[model samples]
Target: MAARRKPALICCGAALAAAVVLAAVFTALYFTVLRPRPPRVTATVVGTRVSAFALIPSPALNLTFDVAVAAYNPNRAAFEYGEVVTVVRYHGDAVGEAVVPRGEVGARASAEVRAVVEVDAVEVFSSPYFPLEGIAGALPFETATTVAGKAVVLGVLKIRASSVVTCGVTVYPLRKETTSPQCTSTVHVG
Candidate 1:
C-alpha cells in the first residue's frame, strides 16, 4: 500500500510540473508575441477642396480638381517636420513633386502636423500622346498644341521624421487628387 501511494504521488507531481512549465512558456509568448503593435506613422491633409482650372490656353480643357492631405506622426514622441515633398504619381509613374513648405504646422502635444500643398502651373497629362511621364505631362500653356488626356496626381505623402514605434503590417494607401495645374489644393484635416 505504501509503495502504491508513493508511485501515485510521483506521477501527480510530474504532471503538475509539466503544467506549470507550459503555463510559464505560454505567458511569455503572449506578452511578447500577442501584444498589439503601435502605429508608427500616419498621414492626412488639411484645407483640402476643389476648384476649376483655366489658364493661358484659349480653348482650355475643362478640368476641375480636389486637393488635400494631412501628415501625422503615429508615435508617442514629437518629431521635427523636415522637407515635406508631395509627389504626384499617375499610373505608377511620377508626374510631379510639390515641395511643402516647412513650419506648416507641428506640435509635440499632438502627434500631427498640418501640411499645406501649394501647386503652381501643373498640367494634366490625360492624353495618350502626353503620357504622365512625358513632356506633355508638364505641358507648356503658352503652346497652342493640345493633347487631350486623363491623369490623376497621386499624392505620395512622406515626411522626414523619426520614431521608435513599430507599426502593424498594413498598407498606407496613396492619397491623390485630380486637378489641372492651374488649380490648387486647400483641403484640411484634424
Candidate 2:
C-alpha cells in the first residue's frame, strides 16, 4: 500500500509541474505577441533652407530645400528602423529625393533625421500649374515619405512595420522657410 501511494504522489507532482510551465509560456506569449503595440512617428518642418538658380538659355529654375524629420517611439520595446525615403515634389513633379539615416529608437524615445534635397528647374517647370515667372517667390510643394522598420516586443517577438507621411506645404524660397505645412501620417504593422 505504501509503495502504491508513493507512485501516485510522484505522478501528481509531475502533472503540476507541466501545468506551471505551460502557464508561464502562455503569459509570455500574451505580453509579447498577442498584445504587441505599434510605435508612434511624427514629422515637422523645423527648418526649410532653400537655394535657387536659373539657367541662361532655358527658363527652368532649380532649388534646394533642406528639411528636418523627427520620429518618436512610444512602445515599451525598441523600434529599429530600416530605411527612410523622402520624396519632395512641386505641384506634381518630383523635384527632390532624400534617404534618412536608419537607426534604433529606444523604448519611448525620439529620433531626428536630416534630409538635403536638390530640385532641378526643369522638374518644377514641367508642372503645368507651377508659376515659372514667379520662380523667385514662394512655391507650393509636397513631401511624401516612408519609414520601414521592425519593433522588438517584450524582448522576444520582432514585428515588421512601416510609417508613411505626406505633407503639403507652401515654402518661401526667398525666405528659406515653410509656412505651416499640413501633414497626414499612418502606421502599418505586420
Candidate 3:
C-alpha cells in the first residue's frame, strides 16, 4: 500500500509540472507574438520658434522647431529603416506634422535628422479664383495654398544621418487674411 501511494504521488507531481510549463509558454506567446506592436517612433518636440515673413501675395510663417524621435528594436530587425511623423498642436490647433520613412532612416543608423516646416499666409485664404500666375503655365504656389483659420499639416519629411541626426524643422505657415501684415502667431511643437 505504501509503495502504490508513492508512485501515484510522483505521477501527480510530474503532471502538475508539465502543466505549469505549458502555461508559461502560452503566456509568453500571448505577450510577444500575439500582442499588438508598439509604435515605430517615440516622438517629442524639444522646442519651437516662429519667424513670420510676408510673401508678395501673402505672408509666410516659418517655424523653426527642435524635434526628437526614437525607437527600440528588440528583435534587432531592420527597424533602423523606419518612418517618423509628428503632429504639432498649439492652442488646441495643430500647426503641422512630418514623417520620416524607413528608406531614409536605413541609409543612416542611430542618427537624428533635422526637419523644417513652413506655413504661408497667402495659402491661408488661397482661392481657386486666384490661380497662381505662371510665365508659361506652371503655378507652383497654387499647390501650397491653405484656407485661413484652418490648421496646418505639413505632410511628410524624409532624412538620413550618421548613427542618429537630431536637428530642427523650418516650417512656413501661410495665412493670407491680411488682418496683420506682421502675421504673428503662436506655435506648439510636440
Candidate 4:
C-alpha cells in the first residue's frame, strides 16, 4: 500500500509542476505579444477659408472661417471622441470658437471634422501689435483644437486618450486670403 501511494503522490506532483510551467509560459506570451497596446492618433489642420475680415473704422473684425481638421487612428481599435472644441486666437486672446459634435474613427482609419467659426465684433485693439501687422497685410492668428475620447479594443478593453492641436496662420484681410497653416500637436493616453 505504501509503494502504491508513493507512485500516486509523484504523479500528482508532476501534474502540478506541469500546470505551473504552462501558466508561466502563457503569462510571458501575454505580456510580450498578446497584450493590448495603446492607440496612436494624430491631428492636422487641413484647410481654412475666410469669409469676412476687416481692421478698419472701429478696429473690429467680422469674419467667418471654414476650418477642417483630420484625425487619424493607427491601431486595431476604434476611437470614439466625446466632443471637439476649436478656438481661434489673436495675440493669445480668443476671438472665435466652435464646438463639433462627437464622432468616431475606425481602426486604422481617418476622419475629417469641419467647423464654421464666425468672428463677430472681435476687438482688434486689444493687442497693440495688431495694428502693425494689420497694416502690413499679414495678420497672425492661431487655432487650437482639443479632442477627448476613448479607444475600444476588441470590444473589451477601453483606453482613454486625448489630443490637442495648435496651428498658426497668417491672414491678409485686404486680399481675403490666408497662408498655409503650420500645426503642432500633443497626444496623451492612459
Candidate 5:
C-alpha cells in the first residue's frame, strides 16, 4: 500500500508541473504576440482626374482614381494580411470598389497597397444629392472609404482590422488634373 501511494503522489506532481508550464506559455504568448496594439493605417489619392462628361444622349461622367493605402505595423511581430477590399462611397452611395493585393508586413514596417477604381456618372446619379457643379465645375467632393482585411501575428494569432478614411478632393476634367485628397482614418480591431 505504501508503494502504491508513492507512485500516485509522483503522478499528481508531474501533472501539476505540466499544467504550470502550459499556463506560462499561454501567458507569454498573450503578452508578446496576442495583445499587441493594432497597426496604423493611412491613405492618399494619386493620379486621379476627371474625364469629359458624355452628354450626347445623357449626362455621364467618367473618372479614374488611384488611392494608396499604407498599413504601418507597430508591433514586434510581423503582420500577415489577407486580401484587402476597399469600397469608395460618395454621399453614402457606393461609387467604386477595388481589391488590394495581399502581402505580409514585417515587424515595425509599413506596406503600401494601391487600389484603382473607375467611377461613372451612373453611380453618382444614384445618390439622392448629386453635386452637378462638383462634377462639371471645379468643386471639391468627399469620399468615404473603408479598407478591411484579416491580419495575423507570427502567422498564428489572427484578428480583423478595418480602417475608414474620409477624403476631400477635386477633379479637373478640362485640365485633366486633380488635387490630392485630404484623408483621415480611424482603425478598429476585433
Candidate 6:
C-alpha cells in the first residue's frame, strides 16, 4: 500500500506544479499584451471665416471656425464614442459651441472629426480684452473638446473611457487665417 501511495503523491505534485506555471504565464500575458489602453486625442484649428466685424455702434463680431479632431485607439478593441462636444472661449468666457455626431474607432485605428463653431457677437464683444487683442492685429481663443465613450474588448468586456483636448489658437480676422495651435490632452479609463 505504501508503494502504491508513493506514485499517486508524485503524480499529484507534478499536476500542481504544471497548474502554477500555466497561471503565471497567463497573468503575464494579460498584463503585457491583453490589457486595455487609453485612446489618444488631438485637435487643430484648420480654417477661420470672419463674416462680420464692426465697432461703430458697439463691438460686434461674427466668426466661424473649422476644426479637425483626431482620435487614435491603441488597444485591440473597438472604441465607440458618444457625441463630441467642442467649446470655444474668449478670455475664459464661452463664445461658441459645436457638436460632432457619435462615431466608432476600430482597434489600432484613427478617426478624424470635423466641427464648425460659430462665435456669438455678444460674447466676443463682452470681453474687455477683446479691444486690446483686436488692436494688436490678432485675437486669442481657446478650444476645448471632450469625448466620452467605451472600449469593447472581445465583444464582451466593455471599458469606459474619456479624453479631453484643449488648444490655444491665435486668429487674424483680417487675414482670415489662424496660427499654429498649442494643445494639451488627457485621457481617463475606468
Q: Enumerate clash totals for all models, in the order shown.
A: 18, 1, 37, 0, 0, 0
Q: Per-residue lDDT of 1-190 in model 5, one digit per residue for the tens?
A: 9999999999999999999999999899888766666778787776675666654566667887887878898776777676666666666567788877677788889889888888856877666555565456553556655666665666677777777877877766657776777887888898
Candidate 5: regions farther than 4 A off: 1-35, 54-58, 126-136, 149-160
Q: Which rank order by TM-score, best down to worst?
A: 6, 4, 2, 5, 3, 1
Per-residue C-alpha lDDT of model 3 across residues 1-190, encoded as one tens digit per residue: 9999999999999999999999999779756643322213333445545555444574344544445554432222222343544444332234455555544222113444444444332443253422332212212220011111111112222112122222232222342111111111222222
Candidate 3 matches the true fold with a TM-score of 0.34
Evaluation by TM-score, superior candidate among 4 and 5 = 4
> What lDDT is reached at residue 160 by model 4?
80
Report the lDDT tens digits of candidate 4 across residue range 56-152: 5655555666667677776567778877888888888888899999999888788888877775444455677877887787778788888888877
TM-score of every model versus the real structure? 0.31, 0.75, 0.34, 0.75, 0.67, 0.84
Please list the Cα RMSD from the true structure of every candidate, rounded to 1 decimal place: 15.2, 3.8, 13.9, 3.4, 4.2, 2.5
* TM-score for candidate 6, residues paired by index: 0.84
lDDT per model vs. reference: 0.34, 0.74, 0.36, 0.74, 0.73, 0.86
CA lDDT, candidate 4, residue 32: 66
Candidate that scores best on lDDT: 6
Question: Could you tell me the lDDT of residue 172 within candidate 6?
Answer: 82
lDDT of 4 at 36: 44
TM-score for candidate 2:
0.75
Models ranked on lDDT: 6, 4, 2, 5, 3, 1
> Where's the lowest-lDDT run of ten residues in candidate 1?
142-151
Tell me how far the alpha carbon of residue 97 in candidate 1 is from the true structure, in angstroms, after superposition.
3.3
Q: Which is better, 5 or 6, measured by TM-score?
A: 6
Backbone clash total, candidate 4 = 0
Compute the lDDT for candidate 2: 0.74
